[model samples]
Target: MNNFKPYYAVIFTSTQATDIKGYLVMAEKMENLAKQQKGYLGMDSARNEVGITISYWESLEAIKNWKANTAHLFAQQKGREQWYNWYNVRICKVEREYEFTLE
Candidate 1:
């Protein structure tokens, strides 16, 4: 089905981290806190040697708000300081979307 429109997606990609001391704690806090923010659609994350986290937002502003949040700010500092070796964030507009389900 393709009903979603005007949505935004934030893709976070990172390589294996070496000094991720409090990464898990901070990540959990961010996830829980993000759900309480307005315009939150959903989020999905996966990792191996590399990690990726994709979060959906109703608008670009909401995503920006999240990015600038205080807790997120701390997380960002932590990432740069210890957690991630390298990372990149990409924002994209969802012009169309399709999903499938089986029962």
Candidate 2:
């Protein structure tokens, strides 16, 4: 991720539907698309029983533009129709963060 501190984070949590047939393909596409957008800092994601994705952005306008993007809107429609059984999205202002590593 970029050192874009004081950024925004869009947290997406979901449980996949039983039939996730094009989910991975679409997810990859969306990630790639997000990278092309303005103010896209970075993203992190993981999944097992439930999936979580956190996308960092420079501003709320950037987040809003991404949400209203054509392909993303399609993906969102597909997510409601096919990909996710349940999902939640939270947007937050990340004032600060810290990490630990072993050397």
Candidate 3:
């Protein structure tokens, strides 16, 4: 992963029906598309009764680019129309962060 003094984290929380309906395809597309974005850092997602995805980017501009992406826009519309019962998006600047890993 790239290191930076400052960056952004986009947290997406969603409650979805078990019905799902094309969600897997769309979700995969979103992840792959996000990586292709200019300021993308990385992302992780998990699904249970609810789903959460935390994506990182270099700047607000990069985040905006991902949000405004045509395919992503379509998915958003579809989410509103059929996929998600409810969802929330929050963006925060990371002032500091640390992690530890053992291998």
Question: What are the per-model numbers of colliding residue pairs?
Answer: 0, 0, 0
Q: List the residue pairs that clash in candidate 3.
A: none
- Candidate with better lDDT, 2 vs 3: 2
Write candidate 3's Cα lDDT for 33-74 as tens digits: 899999999998998888999999999999988989999999
Candidate 2 ranges with C-alpha deviation above 4 Å: 1-4
Per-residue lDDT over 1-103 for candidate 1, one digit per residue giving the tens place of the 0 to 100 score: 5455678999999985677777788889999999999999999999888899999999989998998899889888988888888899999888887689998
Q: Over the stretch 49-103, how does candidate 2's per-residue lDDT look in tens digits?
A: 9899999999999999999999999999999998899999999999988899999
The total number of steric clashes, by the backbone 3 Å criterion, in model 2 comes to 0
Please report the candidate that would top lDDT against the real structure: 2
- 1 versus 2: better lDDT goes to: 2
lDDT of each: 0.88, 0.96, 0.91
TM-score of each: 0.91, 0.94, 0.91
